[model samples]
Target: MWWSLREKRRRKMSSTHLHSQRPKRTMAQKSMKNPRSRSRFSVKTSENYIERMPPEVILKILSYLDAGSLFCFGFVNKRFQELANNNAMWYRFYAGQQAKKKNPRLIDEVTDGLSVVGIQERPEGYWRKQFFKELAGYNANWKKKLKAIHLYTGLPSQTAQILRSLRVRWAVTLTDGKGRESTSEQTHVHFTDAAVTVSWSAGDWPFIDQLTVLKLHGVVRVPLQCPDEYKPGWKSLLTKVKLNKDVWKLCGSDRLVKLLYTEQGITVGVWQEQREIAFIMVNLHYHQLVERSLLGSCVVQYQPAEHTAAFDDVDPEYGLHGYAAHIELHSTAGSIASGRFSQLFCTKDQISDGHLQLKVISKSNRSQHAPLCGSISLPWRTDALQGQIEGCCMLTLTVFDEAQIPFWCVSAPVAMTTSEQAEVSYDCTGESFFVRYEDAEGKVEIELRWMEDHKQYFMVSLIIFLSISKVNKHFGRDYLPQ
Candidate 1:
C-alpha cells in the first residue's frame, strides 16, 4: 500500500507539478527546435571529483542534508542517488522524526515488530518516504475532518471534551447536561495534564473519523445543539484517579458542579450555600493554589514517586505547622517501569492543626509475579510537628514497592481552612515526562533546570486555596464571573 500510494502520488506530481509551475517560453521546452545544433553551453570536466572522494566522506556529507535536501540530492546523479537513499541517512531521519511523534508505529516498523502488512521488505528510503507521506496523510485527514464542523466552543478545554464526547473513538461514560451517565458501549477514556482525548471502537462510532472539531464554531453540515453559555460540567478522563470517600469531607461529592481542563489549568465549579457556583482553577504544576472565586478552592494532586508529600514538618522556631515535599534520591535512576522513585514537595500554610492523609495509586503498577518487597497499605497519614509548625513545610513518604512502583502522590494541604481536591493524570509513556507548571497566583514563575533524565512520565499535583474573589451580586438571583 505504501509503495503503491507513493508511486501514484509521485506520478501525479511528476505529470502536472513542474508543468504547471513552468513558464511557456522556457529554454528547455524550446530546445527541441534545434536538436541538431550543439548550442554553445559546454564545460569539459576531467573526472567526477565528488565520486573520487571516499564513500565514507560522501555519507558524512549526506548526513548534513535534511529530508528534503536529501531527496533532491537523488536527482543530481547515480552516485548521489545511492548515497542519498542510503539506510544510514534515512534511519537517522526516521529516528529523529519518530522521537518527536507520539506514535510508535514507525519505531515498531524499523525494529522488526511492525504489525502492518507489506512493510517487511522495505528499502532504505522507505522510512524517509513514509515520514513525509504519513504526516501528509494525517494532516490532510484532520483538515478534511475539520472543514465546516460546528463544535461547542469558548472554553478551549470544554470544547475539546465536548467534541471528544460527541465524536466517539471509543465508548465513554458521560454524564449529560442534566446529569445522566453515558450508556455508550465499549469505550475508553484517557487524560493528561494538558489534554483529555476519548476514543472508541470504529464500529461503534460510525461518523467519528469523519467528525471535525472547531475551536471556533461557525457553520456545520449537521445541526449541533449547544447553548451560548459557559457550560461547565464534570468530565471523567482519568480512569485511575477517583474522588473516594475520604477526601469527600473537604469537598462534598454532591457539590461538584462542573469539571473541565484548559491549556492553562483545570477549573471547577461547585455549588455553594449562597445558591451560586464557585469558579476555582487548580494549577497542577508547582502544585500551588493559583485561583479561586467565591467558593472553596480546588487542589490537583497525584501520588509522587519519592513519597515527598509524606514529610511531617515540625520546626521549633516557627508558629504554624506544615511540611515540605522532597529530598533527591539519585542523580541517575534505572528503567521507568516497575521501580521506586523519589519525589519532593515544599508547602507553606496559615492554618495550624491537621493531619494530612494521602492516597497513592498507579494504573500501570501491575506485577503479579514479581517478588513482594514488603506488604504495605497506602493513603498513609502524617501529622504536623507537635501541633506547632513553622515557615517552610516539606514532607516525604517512603513507599515500599511490592511489585511495580507508584507514579504520583495525592494529599490534602496540611492546615488550610477550605481544602478541595481534583484529579490529574498523564500519558506516562511520553517522550517528555514533566509538563510545565503554571503559577495561578499571578506570581513570577522561576525557571527550573534539571541535570538528569529518564523515560518520559508525568509528575503532577494540585494546589487549592480559598477564593479571595468577592461574590458577584446581580440585581437578584445569581451572576458568576467569566
Candidate 2:
C-alpha cells in the first residue's frame, strides 16, 4: 500500500511540470505574432524584401515618379537620395521633363539635386557660395528655367563649368556687326576664351551633327592624334577663302576632289595657274545649301566665273534682233506679189537717228510696173520733226505707182512753205509743180496743191509749223531735228 501511494504522487508531479512547460511555449509564440514584440524581426523582413528587387527595376519605377515624389523618396533614406542623384539616371529624367513641359519646379529640383551631389566634398557653405557666384556670372534666372543662352563676350569659366556639370550642350554664335562703321576696325577676333573640347564615346555625335551646329563660332581645334571616326567639323576656319593645292591636299585627296568638283557640281579642269584663294558660292537646292557641312567646305571656292557664251550674239539692247516682213499691193487688182518675206536688218544707229534707208530687191518675177508697194517699220524710235529752216520747210518724199499703190515712205512729215502762192513745186518723177500754203495759226499751218491743172480734183498736203527758240539751260543744247 505504501509503495503504490508513492508511485502515484511522482506521476502527478511529472505531469504538472509538463503542462507548465506547454503554457510557456504557447505564450512565447503569441508574443512573436504581435509586431511591437518583434520589432527587430520586422526590420529584417523589410530589408530582405527590398534586397530581393533589382536596382535597375527600382530605378525604372522611380523614373516614372514625379519630381515631388522623387524628392519625397529622397528623404526616405540616404540610399534613396544617392540613387535619385545618379548622373545617368537624372540626366535622362531631366531630359524627359524638359521635353514634355517647361516646369520650373522640376528644373529647380534637378539643379538642387545636382548641386548637392556635385559639391558634396566641399565645405558646408562652399557650394552655396559657388552656386550664387555662378548664378551671378551666368546672369541666369534661377526662378525661370533656362531654354537658351547667348554668350556674346565669350563663355565664362563659371558658365562653362555649370554647363558641363549640368551636361548641357549648347550652340555658339559669333557676330561682327559691331565694327561696321570704322574702316580700319577688325571685325572678328581670331581667338576666343570660350574654347570647348568634345570627348565623345559613341562612334559619332548622334544628337550633334552639321545641321545642329549651324551657329558654332570660331575654328574647331582637332587633336593631334584622334580616332579615325572622329572628324573635327573641319578644324580650320578658312571658310570662303580659296585654298592652294598644297593646302587642299592636306584635307585628303578624295576630300579635295569632292571639294573641287563633285560637291559643287563645278566641272573643275586644269587652269593656266593654280587659284590660290577664291571665294566659292554654292548654288544648291534650298535644303541642301542650308546644311552647315555643305556650306563649310563650299564657301571656300566661290569665284564669280564669267558666264560662258550661250548664244552667237547677245546684245544688251534689241535682244536677239531679227526681222520678218510681208509685202502686198492692191490697185484695182486682186494681189501683186504676196509670199514669205523675211529680212534681218543690221544694227544701224541711222535707223534710230531719223534717217533710215532700206532697199528691197523683189524676189517675185513680176515686172517693176506691176504696182509695187511696200512698207517699212524700224526697230527703234526716230527723231521728231521741227518746222521752217530759214523760211524753207523740210518735206519727206513718198513714192507711188501710177495705180496709186504706195511703195516707199519716209519718217518725216511733209512741210509746206508759208507763202500763199499756188506755184510751190515738189519734184515728183523729177517734175516741178506749183503748191499753195496758208498760215492759219502761229506755229501751225496747212498747204494745198493741184495736180496736172485738174481744177475739180486737188492734190492736198498738210503741215504743222514750229519755230526755234533759245535752248533751255536744262536741255543744254540746240534742238535735234526730227
lDDT of all predictions: 0.30, 0.28
Candidate 1, after superposition: displacement of residue 313 in Å? 77
Report the Cα lDDT for candidate 1. 0.30
Candidate 2 structure, TM-score to reference: 0.18
lDDT winner: 1
lDDT of 2 by residue, 1-482 (tens): 89899999999999999998874546457668886776644465546465467878778888786544554565556777666554544444444444345554455444444554564554443432333233223233421322222232111224343433332321222122331111011121111122222211111111111111112212322221334233222321212222223322111112111112212111111111443111111111111111222124322422323323223243423311233222222111122123222342323332322222222332122232122122111011102211111211111222222222222221111122333443433332112222222121112122222234433212222222212121111112233323
Error of 1 at 203 (Å): 47
**Model 1 Cα displacement at 459 (Å)?**
60
Segments of candidate 1 deviating more than 4 angstroms: 1-46, 54-56, 103-121, 134-482
Local error of candidate 2 at 400, Å?
71
TM of each candidate vs. truth: 0.19, 0.18
Best by TM-score: 1
